[model samples]
Target: MTLTSKQRAHLRGLSHSLKPTAHVGKDGVTPAVVRSLLETFQQHELVKVRVLENAPDSAKSLAHEIAEKLAGAHVVQTMGRNVTLYRPDPEEPTIALPR
Candidate 1:
């Protein structure tokens, strides 16, 4: 599902205070990493992922790939050494982005 602008903005604000839950290292999006990310998504709808400098792909590319893998939408707010992704939790949502 696509997120509205207000929902995206709300999610962005919520994610600002959160630290990266997972980090993509030099190996890039590995199976193990993807699995971990999937699990993380279950708990936190909006999660920040740190991308190490050694990662093969750029932050934007990685964010796109991650969003696709999780079947979720992505917002590239920060594109430095880390990239943030916002995927609404399917269950037990702690924060609800504006619908």
Candidate 2:
């Protein structure tokens, strides 16, 4: 799903206090990392993933790659080594996104 500036801003605020759910290291976005992220999404729509300095790619690229692998996921924010992602549950989305 494509998010407007307003929606992205809203999600950014919601993820501010959230700690990094998955940490990407030298392994980059491995299957294990993707699995963990998927599991994290099961509980929370907004998830923060931290890319370690040793990670192969930059935070932006890693975030985009991860978003693509996950169904209907979007990159909400990417700051420094931190990447915030959002993917609401298809059946029942908990977070109410503004138009």
- Candidate number achieving the greatest TM-score relative to the actual structure: 2
The TM-score obtained by model 2 is 0.98
Candidate 1, run of 10 with poorest lDDT: 72-81
Which digits, one per residue and each the tens of the lDDT, describe model 2 over residues 1-87? 599999999999999899998999998899999999989998989999999999999999999999999988999999999999999
Q: Which 10-residue span in candidate 2 carries the lowest summed lDDT?
A: 37-46
Q: What is residue 18's positional error in candidate 1, in angstroms?
A: 0.6
Tens digits of lDDT, candidate 1, 23-95: 8889988888789988888777777889888999898788878777877647636657667777656666677
Error of 2 at 60 (Å): 0.4
User: How far off is residue 69 in model 2, in Å?
Assistant: 0.9
Q: Per-prediction TM-score, please?
A: 0.84, 0.98
Residue pairs in clash, model 1:
none
Off by over 4 Å in 2: none
lDDT of each: 0.77, 0.94
